[model samples]
Target: MKLREALALAIGGDLAHLAEVARQLSSLGVRVEPGGDVVWGPTRLLGKGNNGVVVFCRSRHGDIYACKIRRGDAQRPHLLDEARYLQIANGVGVGPRLYAYTRDVLVMEYVEGTPVADWWRAAGAEERARFVADLLRQARALDLAGISHGELSRPGKHVLVARGGRAVILDFESARPGAQNVTQAANLLRALGLTPPLEALRRYAERRDDLAFNELLSSLLGQLKR
Candidate 1:
């Protein structure tokens, strides 16, 4: 299915929105095979949510991107807010690089890797400990930026581990700003069975106190190193 056809299928009964979506995709020079089971524009379907279907796409220059298209009205009605949050996440290097986002579509750099749970399951003892530590750093970054990833507590589908062991957090549609950033730290402890409140981690990031942060991280890593 080309962009036009895909838009038609996604927007179903709404032909006007369909045309607009097609136009938006064309403006971005995106070509997709939505009819395919697992592929689109030299990329593949990474995941799909009530919000939209996330497909992998490639540019003429051979750059890979993740494209998310709204599902009709979308279960989450705040596409713009999600896009804004994505920009915030990008600012802190916490999520994928966002290319563009419209009322019904979003395009960003494709993060390649396994999910965090899968990665943790396959990692060696030392590697698992290191990965968790890196995850804490990312969470701290988000807290420092005043952005809270509301989904970290159940990050099974929102976190990805790149080939080089880089942890890439995803989906900022539910993020919020406020004090007491403990979701990331608490989530990691529950998911990884390691205990350490994230409050200290957030303070370490806000104060830019690297020595203390490293010391804390090292101490935690020691307990987890196995």
Candidate 2:
């Protein structure tokens, strides 16, 4: 089936409000083409989530972008959150670029990459350790900026493993300010069942000269043991 047809089927044919979504995208200058279709030229669907679909599209000017559309009530909030997070994470190197957003959709620079889950399963121990370190850096940056990715524990939703040792985060629908970075990291590690370098992770967060975060991780991991 065609992509549009497939999208319609995925979203449910009889669902209301989709027409409004399409119209909103047009008003936001998304270049709606003939046949009620948005021309994201040379784009493909990367993945679909429970409430939304993610597509990679090339703009008419030859720029690649990712478009995410959320369904029903999740549309507006997620769109706003993604836009804000992209703004915050722009120079942090842990997120995508925010281009445009409507009530139910978001457009950003496309990240060509793999999910961390698959990458972690296939990577060597060294690469895995590096990935963990990078993830910790990202968490620290978010913490410093006072942002928390609320759904970081959701399997494929948390981290996107890109080419060239680059990692990007996705799904900020629940991101909020004032979250505890250490607790978030612990939760993520526990959910993934991986023993992170907690001492190093803590030192990175605290910016200490000779602090031992591994001991902290050990302590935390031990707590989980009891």
Top of the candidates by TM-score: 1
Tens-place lDDT digits, model 2, residues 1-226: 5655555554432456667666765665553221212333333356556666666545566565667777554434446766677678665665777877875777777776777767766776556556666665676677667787777765555678888656677766667785455546656666666655555565645652224444544554454344
Q: Assess every candidate by TM-score.
A: 0.78, 0.71
Report the poorest 10 consecutive residues by lDDT, candidate 2. Answer: 31-40
The lDDT for every candidate, in the order shown, is 0.68, 0.61
Clashes of each: 0, 3
Query: What's the CA error at residue 213 for candidate 2, in Å?
Result: 6.2
